[model samples]
Target: MAECPVIEADELEKRLGNSIIVDCRYSLSDPEYGLRAYLSGHIPGAHFLDLEKDLSGPKGRHGGRHPLPPPEQFREVIERIGGTESSEYVAYDDDLTGASRFWFLCRYFGIRNVRVLNGGWEKWVREGRPVSTEVPSARRGHFQPHPAAGMVVDINWVRRMGRGYVLVDSRQRERYLGVHEAIDPKAGHIPGAVNIPYTAVTSGRGTLRPKEELEGVYRGLGGRPVVYCGSGVTACVNVLAMKLVGLDPLLYSGSWSDWVSYEDSPVATGEE
Candidate 1:
């Protein structure tokens, strides 16, 4: 098997002192949830990084709900978190969503030594590993951002690409079918995207499925895929899952929200 982009909890425990462990626990419904959890207790030496403030940029007419911060801005964030280009980053959330977002962001900005913590915070706690409430002082880190081209595709590109690529909707089937939309002004999905909810990549325990299992799940998706979701957060979970199976997929960062922002863009409901 190829080297996966995930680091298991036990492996993380051994690397805690040397690596930068970021507690990326976040809730879309409650912005303060992650910080509160971090303050209450987190992995020893782990620093808290907020999703909205740190991970995303200002929302506007387009670019979806969670936009990527500018390269320099992201570089500053890396420095604030005491992360250098050479530092190994291990990001964790209660589930893989937030951590996967961090992982994708790091990769998009060309930070190569980043990985998501497999099974995340819940698994760490379940294992009864060490936890702490102490927040460490920021150490100045010399990190530079080199944003990778083609790592993320904008809405216009997605529009041009059309159904040529395997367009994957990483949201739940209901959201894809326009049954219920918790967020975004409109319901349904891009005209041709197929539903492949991010949850399929994980087991009931919230950890990712075995590599072979994940390969089987994505095997028939056909070639390199283009993955998207409500606002581009969970889509990275699919990207991570694909990488674990040795498949490289592109991300539609603007995703469905940006798609709906344009009134002329077509939307489809019901399963294909």
Candidate 2:
């Protein structure tokens, strides 16, 4: 929530010339969908960032489907997007997930001046805002990434985290309960992790809810919140939600997918 600051379409339009706007529209089901969408039309002067290619690292035995991109690769993305320490960076996506993902990475890498575009590209296009097929190349930036220590946690950390932390499962209730499993191999969630679907943080219009509503969504959660979802993608929504409510949250980058990769990792089903 820088408590995940967001820029509305109007404000973004006004700041388009000064801000580094990126189009991060990606679909998990279709690997090439995002690039095709960008090619069709995108925000004027917006650069495209592919989800798998740019935002995540290579998948192997176990780091979830979308682990954080390598430092050098991500730094290149930042520089390509003209992300200087002082520059304002704005990101937008179709489902808002990509925007939040972009925002989380920006903060994780110590870029403090980044924000998601409110309501995403849907809102912008619905309002008849400018769209262009021509892509723009940004001037290379001198931004060096300063990754925050412990902002992200690994499997061992989560395994031994104990009950001191509030482990929030940022997935749908069904997914958390193991009633409906799709992407990952095993169903169910981390033991002791409370269900707080990432969708709770946003309005139906794909914009973040007001602070009051966000507070309601996270009420009664006291300890430090550690959030995760399938492959750690949607988890950013919950992370951003915690940020909005003035709570510093940690990301379980491996999420459920990684948890299940280990045969002995405990899995809990149904509501506690």
Candidate 3:
């Protein structure tokens, strides 16, 4: 079995100096929130990754709000952060949702040694762990993109979905139901998609819930799960959950935003 990418606070603290800890904190509402918060203070020695600038790519018409960055540009980011094939990395934010995005992107780009901080920044601060206003510079390192195959699928793939595909919407129930739309223009999910709000994967304290609990939420879903959210961001939370529990799932990289972009695409509302 592959090792889970989620790490607890205590383990992360001990590995601080030995790891490339990335602060992936962001707020969808206020785009500037992440950098502002980072400037105030963050985990000692942690580098900041803006959800929009660093993690996501230049958005075009069809790709969602947060498209994957161009491969060469992303390679530059990795090298700039002193990441190499051998570097151990940790990403943390207010909760797993934010950090999980970094975890997913790194692994997809072939940086397999990264982990998301379980319980994330909230847990770290609540436990009285150290914080720092000073930033540490890292020595440059070499890296190359080895994009993983079949990890992502585009909108056309979703349109021609088979009965065997288990499409999952990672937004909240209301958003999934089309009862309360906010970010995306559409108010429903991909036809036949099921609701599994990413929050279900985390505990009240913001850490992942027990393994068995996760299994119950995802096991025997009966097909390959292709998860998406309003855009392609929070869906990573569900992707991280499924992978953590030994399940293989694909990400609909453009997600609902791309889905709704096509004038003729189908949308399903209410239960299921």
Cα lDDT of model 3 by residue, 36-68, tens digit: 999898999999888888889999888988898
Task: State residue 265's C-alpha deviation in candidate 1, in Å.
Answer: 0.5
Candidate 2 residue pairs in backbone clash:
1-4, 1-244, 2-5
**Candidate 1, overall lDDT?**
0.88
Off by over 4 Å in 2: 1-4
Residue 129's C-alpha lDDT in candidate 3?
A: 98
Greater TM-score among 1 and 2 belongs to 1
* TM-score for each predicted model, relative to the true structure: 0.97, 0.96, 0.97
TM-score of decoy 1: 0.97
**Model 3 residue 32 CA deviation in Å:** 1.7
